[model samples]
Target: MDLIEVLQHRYTAKAYNPDRRLPEEIVAQLMAALRFSPSSVNAQPWHFIVAGDEAGKARVAKGAAGPFAYNAPKILNASHVVLLCARTTLPPEHLQAVLDQEQADGRFAGEEAREGQRKTRAGYVALHEQAGDLGMWTQKQAYIALGFLLLAAGTLGVDATPMEGFDAEALDGAFGLTDKGLAPAVIVALGYHSDADFNAKLPKSRLADSVVFSRA
Candidate 1:
Protein backbone atom coordinates (compact mmCIF):
# COMPACT_ATOMS: atom_id res chain seq x y z
CA MET A 1 0.00 0.00 0.00
CA ASP A 2 1.05 3.60 -0.48
CA LEU A 3 2.43 5.44 2.55
CA ILE A 4 -0.50 7.83 2.71
CA GLU A 5 -3.03 5.01 2.42
CA VAL A 6 -1.28 3.03 5.10
CA LEU A 7 -1.39 6.08 7.32
CA GLN A 8 -5.02 6.83 6.55
CA HIS A 9 -6.16 3.35 7.51
CA ARG A 10 -3.97 3.00 10.59
CA TYR A 11 -5.35 3.58 14.06
CA THR A 12 -3.87 3.35 17.51
CA ALA A 13 -4.61 -0.24 18.50
CA LYS A 14 -5.23 -0.33 22.21
CA ALA A 15 -6.29 -3.95 22.18
CA TYR A 16 -4.38 -6.90 20.77
CA ASN A 17 -5.08 -10.50 19.89
CA PRO A 18 -2.84 -12.52 22.18
CA ASP A 19 -2.65 -15.55 19.91
CA ARG A 20 -0.88 -13.59 17.19
CA ARG A 21 2.85 -13.15 17.12
CA LEU A 22 4.66 -11.11 14.50
CA PRO A 23 7.34 -12.97 12.54
CA GLU A 24 10.94 -12.51 13.71
CA GLU A 25 12.06 -11.19 10.34
CA ILE A 26 9.31 -8.57 10.36
CA VAL A 27 10.30 -7.42 13.85
CA ALA A 28 13.88 -7.04 12.71
CA GLN A 29 12.77 -5.04 9.73
CA LEU A 30 10.73 -2.71 11.91
CA MET A 31 13.67 -2.02 14.19
CA ALA A 32 16.01 -1.55 11.25
CA ALA A 33 13.67 1.15 10.02
CA LEU A 34 13.81 2.86 13.39
CA ARG A 35 17.60 2.92 13.31
CA PHE A 36 17.47 5.18 10.28
CA SER A 37 15.03 7.71 11.73
CA PRO A 38 16.33 11.30 11.72
CA SER A 39 17.72 12.76 14.90
CA SER A 40 19.88 15.73 15.93
CA VAL A 41 22.76 15.58 13.47
CA ASN A 42 21.96 11.92 12.88
CA ALA A 43 22.86 11.02 16.43
CA GLN A 44 20.12 8.40 15.97
CA PRO A 45 20.00 7.63 19.66
CA TRP A 46 17.52 4.97 20.74
CA HIS A 47 17.43 1.38 21.95
CA PHE A 48 14.76 -1.29 21.50
CA ILE A 49 14.16 -4.46 23.48
CA VAL A 50 11.37 -6.52 21.99
CA ALA A 51 9.81 -8.90 24.47
CA GLY A 52 7.69 -11.50 22.69
CA ASP A 53 7.07 -13.60 25.75
CA GLU A 54 4.21 -13.03 28.19
CA ALA A 55 6.40 -13.06 31.27
CA GLY A 56 8.57 -10.24 30.01
CA LYS A 57 5.58 -8.17 28.98
CA ALA A 58 4.01 -8.52 32.40
CA ARG A 59 7.17 -7.43 34.09
CA VAL A 60 7.17 -4.23 32.06
CA ALA A 61 3.45 -3.66 32.64
CA LYS A 62 3.84 -3.92 36.38
CA GLY A 63 6.57 -1.33 36.42
CA ALA A 64 4.83 1.22 34.24
CA ALA A 65 1.20 2.03 35.02
CA GLY A 66 -0.84 5.14 34.38
CA PRO A 67 -4.50 6.00 34.90
CA PHE A 68 -5.56 5.14 31.33
CA ALA A 69 -3.77 1.81 31.39
CA TYR A 70 -6.53 0.25 33.47
CA ASN A 71 -8.61 -2.12 31.30
CA ALA A 72 -5.81 -2.11 28.78
CA PRO A 73 -5.61 -5.87 29.12
CA LYS A 74 -5.15 -6.39 25.43
CA ILE A 75 -2.12 -4.20 25.61
CA LEU A 76 -0.79 -5.99 28.66
CA ASN A 77 -1.84 -9.35 27.30
CA ALA A 78 -0.38 -8.91 23.86
CA SER A 79 2.03 -11.54 22.59
CA HIS A 80 4.95 -9.15 22.26
CA VAL A 81 6.08 -5.91 23.90
CA VAL A 82 8.81 -3.52 22.90
CA LEU A 83 10.70 -1.40 25.40
CA LEU A 84 12.03 1.69 23.65
CA CYS A 85 15.23 2.79 25.28
CA ALA A 86 17.42 5.89 25.64
CA ARG A 87 20.95 5.56 26.84
CA THR A 88 23.73 7.61 28.38
CA THR A 89 26.19 6.35 25.82
CA LEU A 90 25.47 5.28 22.27
CA PRO A 91 26.17 1.67 21.41
CA PRO A 92 29.32 1.07 19.36
CA GLU A 93 27.79 -1.36 16.90
CA HIS A 94 24.95 0.99 15.98
CA LEU A 95 27.18 4.03 15.59
CA GLN A 96 29.50 2.49 13.00
CA ALA A 97 26.61 1.54 10.74
CA VAL A 98 25.34 5.13 10.59
CA LEU A 99 28.84 6.43 10.02
CA ASP A 100 29.00 4.09 7.04
CA GLN A 101 25.86 5.76 5.71
CA GLU A 102 27.27 9.28 6.25
CA GLN A 103 30.27 8.22 4.17
CA ALA A 104 27.95 7.22 1.35
CA ASP A 105 25.29 9.95 1.74
CA GLY A 106 27.71 12.85 2.15
CA ARG A 107 26.01 13.84 5.37
CA PHE A 108 29.44 14.17 6.90
CA ALA A 109 31.22 15.15 3.67
CA GLY A 110 33.95 12.53 4.07
CA GLU A 111 34.52 13.62 7.63
CA GLU A 112 34.58 11.67 10.97
CA ALA A 113 33.55 8.40 9.26
CA ARG A 114 36.75 7.49 7.46
CA GLU A 115 38.11 5.27 10.21
CA GLY A 116 36.39 1.95 10.80
CA GLN A 117 34.82 3.49 13.87
CA ARG A 118 32.39 1.34 15.76
CA LYS A 119 30.58 4.40 17.08
CA THR A 120 30.29 8.14 16.51
CA ARG A 121 30.55 10.53 19.44
CA ALA A 122 27.63 12.89 19.93
CA GLY A 123 25.90 14.80 22.74
CA TYR A 124 25.13 18.29 23.95
CA VAL A 125 28.55 19.94 24.02
CA ALA A 126 27.42 23.10 25.73
CA LEU A 127 27.49 22.24 29.39
CA HIS A 128 26.03 25.61 30.23
CA GLU A 129 22.94 25.06 28.09
CA GLN A 130 19.70 24.93 30.05
CA ALA A 131 18.46 21.52 31.09
CA GLY A 132 15.35 22.04 28.97
CA ASP A 133 17.40 21.82 25.80
CA LEU A 134 18.67 18.39 26.74
CA GLY A 135 15.20 17.29 27.73
CA MET A 136 13.76 18.43 24.42
CA TRP A 137 16.55 16.76 22.49
CA THR A 138 15.98 13.48 24.30
CA GLN A 139 12.24 13.50 23.79
CA LYS A 140 12.56 14.44 20.13
CA GLN A 141 14.76 11.46 19.34
CA ALA A 142 12.47 9.18 21.33
CA TYR A 143 9.44 10.29 19.34
CA ILE A 144 11.28 9.61 16.10
CA ALA A 145 11.63 6.03 17.25
CA LEU A 146 7.94 5.96 18.06
CA GLY A 147 6.99 7.28 14.63
CA PHE A 148 9.15 4.77 12.77
CA LEU A 149 8.01 1.78 14.81
CA LEU A 150 4.34 2.67 14.51
CA LEU A 151 4.52 3.08 10.74
CA ALA A 152 6.55 -0.08 10.24
CA ALA A 153 4.16 -2.09 12.38
CA GLY A 154 1.18 -0.76 10.47
CA THR A 155 2.87 -1.69 7.20
CA LEU A 156 3.46 -5.24 8.40
CA GLY A 157 -0.07 -5.59 9.82
CA VAL A 158 1.13 -5.67 13.41
CA ASP A 159 -1.15 -3.39 15.36
CA ALA A 160 0.43 -1.51 18.25
CA THR A 161 -0.04 1.26 20.82
CA PRO A 162 2.54 3.86 21.69
CA MET A 163 2.09 3.84 25.46
CA GLU A 164 3.37 6.55 27.80
CA GLY A 165 0.75 6.06 30.44
CA PHE A 166 3.23 4.39 32.72
CA ASP A 167 5.85 5.00 35.33
CA ALA A 168 9.29 5.40 33.80
CA GLU A 169 11.27 5.24 37.03
CA ALA A 170 9.46 2.14 38.20
CA LEU A 171 9.89 0.52 34.81
CA ASP A 172 13.61 1.20 34.66
CA GLY A 173 14.05 -0.36 38.06
CA ALA A 174 11.90 -3.38 37.32
CA PHE A 175 13.56 -4.08 34.01
CA GLY A 176 17.00 -3.53 35.57
CA LEU A 177 17.59 -1.39 32.52
CA THR A 178 20.56 0.21 34.22
CA ASP A 179 22.52 -2.95 33.47
CA LYS A 180 22.42 -2.04 29.84
CA GLY A 181 22.92 1.64 30.64
CA LEU A 182 19.52 2.40 29.15
CA ALA A 183 16.02 3.35 30.22
CA PRO A 184 12.56 3.29 28.67
CA ALA A 185 11.46 6.26 26.62
CA VAL A 186 8.27 4.52 25.62
CA ILE A 187 6.50 1.15 25.64
CA VAL A 188 5.02 -0.18 22.41
CA ALA A 189 2.90 -3.28 22.74
CA LEU A 190 2.35 -5.21 19.51
CA GLY A 191 0.03 -8.04 18.46
CA TYR A 192 -3.21 -8.84 16.62
CA HIS A 193 -6.65 -7.52 17.58
CA SER A 194 -9.10 -8.82 20.13
CA ASP A 195 -12.60 -7.61 20.94
CA ALA A 196 -11.38 -5.54 23.90
CA ASP A 197 -9.61 -2.27 24.73
CA PHE A 198 -11.66 0.15 22.67
CA ASN A 199 -10.41 3.53 23.82
CA ALA A 200 -9.00 6.81 22.44
CA LYS A 201 -11.18 6.60 19.31
CA LEU A 202 -12.66 9.90 18.21
CA PRO A 203 -12.22 12.55 15.63
CA LYS A 204 -8.81 14.09 16.07
CA SER A 205 -9.13 17.51 17.67
CA ARG A 206 -6.88 20.03 16.07
CA LEU A 207 -6.61 23.70 15.28
CA ALA A 208 -7.22 24.42 11.61
CA ASP A 209 -4.08 24.33 9.48
CA SER A 210 -4.40 28.05 8.89
CA VAL A 211 -4.56 28.66 12.61
CA VAL A 212 -1.21 26.96 12.96
CA PHE A 213 0.41 28.83 10.07
CA SER A 214 1.98 32.27 9.94
CA ARG A 215 0.95 34.12 6.75
CA ALA A 216 2.70 37.38 7.19
Candidate 2:
Protein backbone atom coordinates (compact mmCIF):
# COMPACT_ATOMS: atom_id res chain seq x y z
CA MET A 1 0.00 0.00 0.00
CA ASP A 2 1.04 3.60 -0.49
CA LEU A 3 2.02 5.65 2.55
CA ILE A 4 -1.38 7.34 2.87
CA GLU A 5 -3.28 4.09 2.49
CA VAL A 6 -1.02 2.38 4.97
CA LEU A 7 -1.66 5.13 7.49
CA GLN A 8 -5.38 4.96 6.86
CA HIS A 9 -5.54 1.19 7.32
CA ARG A 10 -3.32 0.80 10.37
CA TYR A 11 -4.70 0.88 13.90
CA THR A 12 -3.63 -0.24 17.35
CA ALA A 13 -4.09 -3.99 17.46
CA LYS A 14 -5.54 -4.75 20.87
CA ALA A 15 -5.48 -8.49 20.32
CA TYR A 16 -3.05 -10.54 18.27
CA ASN A 17 -3.45 -13.88 16.55
CA PRO A 18 -1.21 -16.09 18.62
CA ASP A 19 -1.32 -18.71 15.89
CA ARG A 20 0.30 -16.34 13.43
CA ARG A 21 3.97 -15.59 13.95
CA LEU A 22 5.84 -12.94 12.01
CA PRO A 23 8.45 -14.11 9.50
CA GLU A 24 12.12 -13.43 10.21
CA GLU A 25 12.53 -11.27 7.10
CA ILE A 26 9.73 -8.88 8.10
CA VAL A 27 11.19 -8.59 11.61
CA ALA A 28 14.59 -7.79 10.06
CA GLN A 29 13.11 -4.94 8.05
CA LEU A 30 11.42 -3.46 11.13
CA MET A 31 14.69 -3.61 13.05
CA ALA A 32 16.49 -1.92 10.19
CA ALA A 33 13.89 0.85 10.16
CA LEU A 34 14.48 1.39 13.88
CA ARG A 35 18.28 1.31 13.51
CA PHE A 36 18.03 4.11 10.98
CA SER A 37 15.66 6.30 13.06
CA PRO A 38 16.78 9.92 13.39
CA SER A 39 17.96 11.38 16.66
CA SER A 40 18.98 14.79 17.88
CA VAL A 41 22.65 15.34 17.05
CA ASN A 42 22.58 11.64 16.12
CA ALA A 43 23.27 10.91 19.81
CA GLN A 44 21.25 7.70 19.39
CA PRO A 45 20.82 7.33 23.13
CA TRP A 46 18.61 4.26 23.15
CA HIS A 47 18.46 0.45 23.27
CA PHE A 48 15.77 -1.95 22.07
CA ILE A 49 14.85 -5.21 23.80
CA VAL A 50 13.14 -7.61 21.41
CA ALA A 51 11.14 -10.41 23.04
CA GLY A 52 10.26 -13.26 20.67
CA ASP A 53 10.28 -16.36 22.84
CA GLU A 54 7.60 -17.38 25.32
CA ALA A 55 9.95 -16.94 28.28
CA GLY A 56 11.12 -13.54 27.10
CA LYS A 57 7.58 -12.37 26.37
CA ALA A 58 6.43 -13.61 29.77
CA ARG A 59 9.23 -11.72 31.43
CA VAL A 60 8.20 -8.56 29.62
CA ALA A 61 4.53 -9.18 30.47
CA LYS A 62 5.44 -9.25 34.13
CA GLY A 63 6.15 -5.59 33.80
CA ALA A 64 2.47 -4.98 33.11
CA ALA A 65 1.22 -6.38 36.36
CA GLY A 66 -1.20 -4.63 38.75
CA PRO A 67 -2.49 -1.36 37.28
CA PHE A 68 -1.10 -2.27 33.86
CA ALA A 69 -2.56 -5.78 33.71
CA TYR A 70 -4.44 -4.95 30.53
CA ASN A 71 -1.17 -4.83 28.63
CA ALA A 72 0.07 -8.24 29.73
CA PRO A 73 -2.05 -10.35 27.38
CA LYS A 74 -1.31 -8.05 24.48
CA ILE A 75 2.40 -8.47 25.04
CA LEU A 76 2.10 -12.21 25.57
CA ASN A 77 -0.06 -12.88 22.53
CA ALA A 78 1.88 -10.79 20.05
CA SER A 79 4.46 -12.52 17.85
CA HIS A 80 7.07 -10.16 19.28
CA VAL A 81 7.32 -7.41 21.86
CA VAL A 82 9.88 -4.62 21.71
CA LEU A 83 10.83 -2.60 24.75
CA LEU A 84 12.06 0.82 23.76
CA CYS A 85 14.59 2.09 26.24
CA ALA A 86 16.50 5.35 26.56
CA ARG A 87 19.93 5.85 28.05
CA THR A 88 19.95 7.58 31.42
CA THR A 89 22.71 9.77 30.10
CA LEU A 90 24.45 10.40 26.82
CA PRO A 91 28.11 10.05 27.83
CA PRO A 92 30.99 11.47 25.81
CA GLU A 93 32.02 7.98 24.81
CA HIS A 94 28.65 7.33 23.21
CA LEU A 95 29.03 10.39 20.97
CA GLN A 96 32.58 9.31 20.13
CA ALA A 97 31.32 5.89 19.12
CA VAL A 98 28.82 7.43 16.69
CA LEU A 99 31.58 9.62 15.26
CA ASP A 100 33.88 6.63 14.87
CA GLN A 101 31.21 4.70 12.99
CA GLU A 102 30.50 7.73 10.78
CA GLN A 103 34.17 7.94 9.83
CA ALA A 104 34.42 4.23 9.14
CA ASP A 105 31.25 4.40 7.03
CA GLY A 106 32.71 7.26 4.96
CA ARG A 107 30.04 9.68 6.13
CA PHE A 108 32.74 12.27 6.61
CA ALA A 109 34.51 13.71 3.55
CA GLY A 110 37.70 14.30 5.50
CA GLU A 111 39.20 14.99 8.93
CA GLU A 112 37.73 18.52 8.87
CA ALA A 113 34.21 17.15 8.35
CA ARG A 114 34.68 14.55 11.08
CA GLU A 115 35.93 17.17 13.52
CA GLY A 116 33.04 19.46 12.59
CA GLN A 117 30.52 16.73 13.27
CA ARG A 118 32.09 15.96 16.65
CA LYS A 119 31.99 19.60 17.68
CA THR A 120 28.42 20.15 16.52
CA ARG A 121 27.15 16.95 18.16
CA ALA A 122 28.96 17.75 21.39
CA GLY A 123 27.47 21.22 21.43
CA TYR A 124 23.94 19.80 21.14
CA VAL A 125 24.61 17.25 23.85
CA ALA A 126 25.94 19.96 26.16
CA LEU A 127 22.92 22.10 25.45
CA HIS A 128 20.56 19.29 26.46
CA GLU A 129 22.67 18.44 29.52
CA GLN A 130 22.44 22.02 30.75
CA ALA A 131 18.65 21.78 30.34
CA GLY A 132 18.81 19.15 33.12
CA ASP A 133 16.46 16.66 31.51
CA LEU A 134 18.87 14.60 29.48
CA GLY A 135 17.03 11.37 30.19
CA MET A 136 13.70 12.85 29.15
CA TRP A 137 15.34 14.22 26.03
CA THR A 138 16.71 10.79 25.28
CA GLN A 139 13.29 9.23 25.78
CA LYS A 140 11.90 11.63 23.19
CA GLN A 141 14.44 10.31 20.69
CA ALA A 142 13.33 6.75 21.46
CA TYR A 143 9.77 7.74 20.60
CA ILE A 144 10.96 8.81 17.16
CA ALA A 145 12.17 5.26 16.67
CA LEU A 146 8.82 4.04 17.97
CA GLY A 147 7.05 6.09 15.31
CA PHE A 148 9.35 4.70 12.66
CA LEU A 149 8.66 1.14 13.79
CA LEU A 150 4.89 1.66 13.71
CA LEU A 151 4.98 3.09 10.20
CA ALA A 152 7.27 0.35 8.98
CA ALA A 153 5.03 -2.29 10.50
CA GLY A 154 2.04 -0.81 8.69
CA THR A 155 3.95 -0.84 5.42
CA LEU A 156 4.83 -4.48 6.01
CA GLY A 157 1.20 -5.45 6.80
CA VAL A 158 2.12 -6.24 10.36
CA ASP A 159 -0.34 -5.25 13.07
CA ALA A 160 1.07 -3.41 16.09
CA THR A 161 0.07 -1.66 19.28
CA PRO A 162 2.17 1.04 20.92
CA MET A 163 1.99 0.87 24.70
CA GLU A 164 3.11 3.18 27.48
CA GLY A 165 1.02 1.57 30.21
CA PHE A 166 3.65 -0.70 31.72
CA ASP A 167 5.66 -0.02 34.83
CA ALA A 168 8.95 1.46 33.68
CA GLU A 169 10.80 0.86 36.94
CA ALA A 170 9.55 -2.71 37.18
CA LEU A 171 10.48 -3.44 33.57
CA ASP A 172 13.91 -1.97 34.13
CA GLY A 173 14.39 -4.20 37.15
CA ALA A 174 13.06 -7.29 35.38
CA PHE A 175 15.37 -6.78 32.40
CA GLY A 176 18.32 -5.25 34.30
CA LEU A 177 18.04 -2.10 32.25
CA THR A 178 19.46 0.16 34.95
CA ASP A 179 22.64 -1.91 35.19
CA LYS A 180 22.94 -1.38 31.46
CA GLY A 181 22.27 2.39 31.80
CA LEU A 182 18.92 2.05 30.02
CA ALA A 183 15.34 2.77 31.14
CA PRO A 184 12.10 1.59 29.58
CA ALA A 185 10.14 4.22 27.73
CA VAL A 186 7.46 2.28 25.85
CA ILE A 187 6.56 -1.01 24.14
CA VAL A 188 5.33 -2.15 20.75
CA ALA A 189 3.52 -5.48 20.38
CA LEU A 190 3.67 -6.77 16.81
CA GLY A 191 1.87 -9.53 14.88
CA TYR A 192 -1.34 -10.29 13.02
CA HIS A 193 -4.57 -9.15 14.68
CA SER A 194 -6.89 -11.68 16.21
CA ASP A 195 -10.38 -12.29 14.76
CA ALA A 196 -11.87 -10.95 17.99
CA ASP A 197 -10.05 -7.59 17.86
CA PHE A 198 -12.88 -5.06 17.91
CA ASN A 199 -10.45 -2.20 17.35
CA ALA A 200 -9.66 -3.63 13.92
CA LYS A 201 -13.11 -2.69 12.69
CA LEU A 202 -13.39 0.70 14.34
CA PRO A 203 -13.18 3.70 12.09
CA LYS A 204 -10.09 5.84 12.44
CA SER A 205 -10.64 9.18 14.15
CA ARG A 206 -8.63 12.37 14.07
CA LEU A 207 -9.09 16.10 14.47
CA ALA A 208 -9.73 18.08 11.29
CA ASP A 209 -6.69 19.55 9.58
CA SER A 210 -7.92 23.10 10.17
CA VAL A 211 -7.74 22.46 13.91
CA VAL A 212 -4.65 20.24 13.85
CA PHE A 213 -2.52 22.48 11.63
CA SER A 214 -2.26 26.11 10.57
CA ARG A 215 -0.40 28.16 7.96
CA ALA A 216 1.40 31.28 9.04
Top-scoring candidate (lDDT)? 2
TM values, all candidates: 0.74, 0.98
Candidate 2 lDDT, 56-106, residue by residue in tens: 999899889999999998999999999999999878788889999999998
lDDT of each: 0.69, 0.93
Error of 2 at 208 (Å): 1.3
Full-model lDDT, candidate 1: 0.69
Query: Model 2 lDDT vs. the true structure?
Result: 0.93
Q: What CA root-mean-square deviation does each model show from the true structure?
A: 4.4, 0.9
Backbone collision tally, model 1:
1
How much is 115 displaced in model 2, in angstroms? 0.9
Identify the runs in model 1 with alpha carbons over 4 angstroms from their true place.
65-72, 88-124, 127-132, 178-180, 197-216
In TM-score terms, which candidate is top? 2
